[model samples]
Target: LEGADGPGLFNAAQTLRQLVTRESSKGKGSKGDKGSRGFAGVTVRDWPASPVRGITEGFYGDAWSQQERLEQLDFLGRTKQNRYLYASTDDPYRQSSHWRDPYPAAQRAEFRALAERARRNHVTLGWAVSPGQGLCFSSDEDRRALLRKVDAMRALGFGAFQLRFEDVSYSEWHCDEDARTYGSGPKAAARAQAELANAVARHLSARHPGTEPLSVMPTEFYQDGATDYRSALAEKLEQGVQIAWSGVGVVPRTITGGELADARSAFRQHPLVTMDDYPVNDYAQDRIFLGPYRGREPAVASGSAALLSNAMRQPTASRVPLFTAADYAWNPKRYDPEASWEAAIDAVAAGSGTEEAREGAREAVHALAGNDASSLLGGRESAYLRPLLAEFWAAYDAADSDKKSEVKRLRRAADQLLDAFGTMRTARERVPDALEREVRPWLRELARRGEAGEQAVKMLTAQARGDGGAAWDARLALKQLRADGPERGAVVGKGVLADFEKRALETSERWAGVRRKAFGDQTVHGGPTARPDSPAEAAVDGDPDTAYRA
Candidate 1:
């Protein structure tokens, strides 16, 4: 505490709180317990690797409520995050067509209160405006309108502002005035954006006096390599303005040091802040990614000025991944995804302060993680299912006698998973409401899919025993359980049941010939055979060359 400032002191306090909670969970150092009375010899000397480590609510879905934003600020403070970007595409005045309008009385009050809350939490409320959608950039009136909007927010106590030109059409001018003044090309657009940003930065500096550097997100923020527009923007944009880059692609699978270095070179050494688009599951509403933060090289921190995670619409659900992101930004070199994730789970679960609540929260995290489909970072599934899948797969690939035991084990695992889902559905008071709301649908789907998998196992076993009636019943049940694609509420584990049904049918049909022979003279209807020159079968068999030759 001697050398630590506000954030450093806050982080130290959080670490100590976590240490006490952990020890308490282990039944040590409690009121009635016999244990050491002093601190656990743990010392944390922590500081952020990047100057700006935070979350940006710059998504395209439903905006988080003011209460949610306030709660998120508290969570960010607890996790040691120091910045919050209040840019949601759904907000018309903030982005979209109504860029020049001021917030109404009620909304302005909300902003003032939010700014106050942010101050209490030591978080910088970075206000952002997006006028590039239809701004006549060359018009004096248009420039004044943009400045007026920033001025209003500055009055509400926001010391940071971002001019967002991202996702806007900069290939051509918005009006005849811009076209006549700067011509219709990338350089013209870059010049217009640069001038507007420079003006805003200068105005903020002169008026606000100790404001943080201005931030901007250009239209071509994500790139495989630099373009004329990027180069021009880099050269023309004011040196004090920080540029936001989204790695190689808009939603890249990985971000490496090479990509960052290339982007830095493209931007002519201007301050680059990474606008990471992970754990933001808006694009694929069928997924709620509960995976630990991964795919960002440690060198990314040193290569950029700051790192900001783009958050999902569900603020509570986003905590698990954001927690890992906070750790990475604090100390990228020694960041461990698994350790951070486990700690996050513990922190979230222990928030309710009971063993039962902790157990329920852990279960919810597992269920949600099971539904994640991120290819870059792996996700967690129900504890029972993880081992069950392994056992089932191992037995499946083994001899026939081993199959029965594995099948029974798989069925038990499925039953246990269903039971867990049932417990979560009913344990309203034991689990967090947000966690339950976000994870319940997936849990129900998982239960249905588990039933389908159990039926498939039974169908396979019945076919092997020549019991056509039982196999037929199981197959019919499996077909009925097949998912009819993803419904709107079906965000997590979408299409999982359908995939299981398809695989089950394929396995069942593979043994049709033997089943027909077993029940001789019964006129059994075997499924359709592979067509003589069918591409589907050829691809499955890896015989494209042979099929073409034939």
Candidate 2:
């Protein structure tokens, strides 16, 4: 807390978490009143170990622009996130200022409008100004550019600036690379960089009178475990300037152990900003959490959901960090990786009458939104698979011929499979209002269990990361839960409705397995794999249709 730019500040925020009532966390997402608050007399506890627990925007090219950035800022605020890293190639307003283009007449006005909206929502916007990279500023020029940028931000009302020192000399805005580089040694280089950056900080504070914090992106070479550059940078992290680390496992689209280790090392020096880790690779593509741009495409939505889910799973401890889902101008590096599908579902389900009705609607809608096994099983059975049988055969014939139509033939197979799955939407749409009402209770219970189950895992992991005694206690609690699985399992000793809920949650959990099984059934995609001999043989005896149809 002395300088207010270290882990201590982060610790203070964590302590603040315990001070907050449990109602806050649950209010964010917990269904009904049954949450951390319900279980005990509300004891809140949270702390971020890193200074910047964040995500970025404006990296993945021109895919995300002004409007998308605003929306993502709102989303970050809802999650209690505290930072925004704007790394776009082209400025939002398409103009430039020396140090920073005084928000320009157009850009400044845009920022002010965005700031008004952000302020209303309790979001503090941070700027990641990269003068050296895109601005073509030399070391001397950088001094001036920094001043201009700071002045511009000050004029527009911003308190923090992330100084990104990326060296891009090949482009049109290229500057003498060495003149702007952070140099070889961390100290000497840092000393020089700090002098320049500190001047900007001082100038901004003096000029704006409300100077925000500054975070400098560390040199890329610091990836080495024991490098002088890192040590110098750590030592030279000027009084007000923090360090930001690039999440490099991206690009190729991977977050490996080595990358995390490097991050931990750099974090030990000072709080670091994490970039390019959002819109997680749900489909395991190189790009993760890279976009929520140009409106909602289903593929993008699903991909964003996957990335958000993955980002949620990371054990990041940065305190004052931000997350963006915007793929600015289509640059993968600056994609906001925080989009919550679960939250989205909850949003859609809000105000849909009773809780049960809301939940039933959620499932139905989810079914329509996907092509997985769970979607297929939403209503009745696989009667639609029969129609695609001929198309499937044609794909097989195409595949066998020595024709050069491999991609097309494979695409044909995929189309037929999708055609079969499309039946889910038809069935979901046909679901009667009476049936929805009938299934409402089961759906609510299912949603509750699914959510609670995931939270239980998170809670245990959280406890494990805490003090030893608490960790041990959490361990025992998990063991007890496991032992009580028979009773704990949603369907165990339950009625027919309870059984259905259990299957639904399980199917959702094993979505991939369900998908494989659906295609692995008596179909061409089932190719060579042993198909379920009697998958559609209906149920076991006694009015099979009534078992699910009713």
lDDT of 2 by residue, 86-195 (tens): 55545542223344444458767878776776665444566666554445334566567567656666556565666656442322334446445533344545455556
The TM-score between candidate 2 and the true structure equals: 0.46
lDDT of 1 by residue, 253-305 (tens): 78999988888888888889899997887777756777788888988876677
Model 2 regions lying over 4 Å from their true place:
1-54, 63-65, 92-104, 134-142, 167-195, 204-211, 221-224, 251-268, 280-344, 348-361, 364-550
Global lDDT scores for all candidate models? 0.73, 0.41
TM-score of each: 0.82, 0.46
Assess candidate 1 and give its TM-score to the true structure.
0.82
The lDDT of model 1 is 0.73
The number of the candidate with the highest lDDT is 1
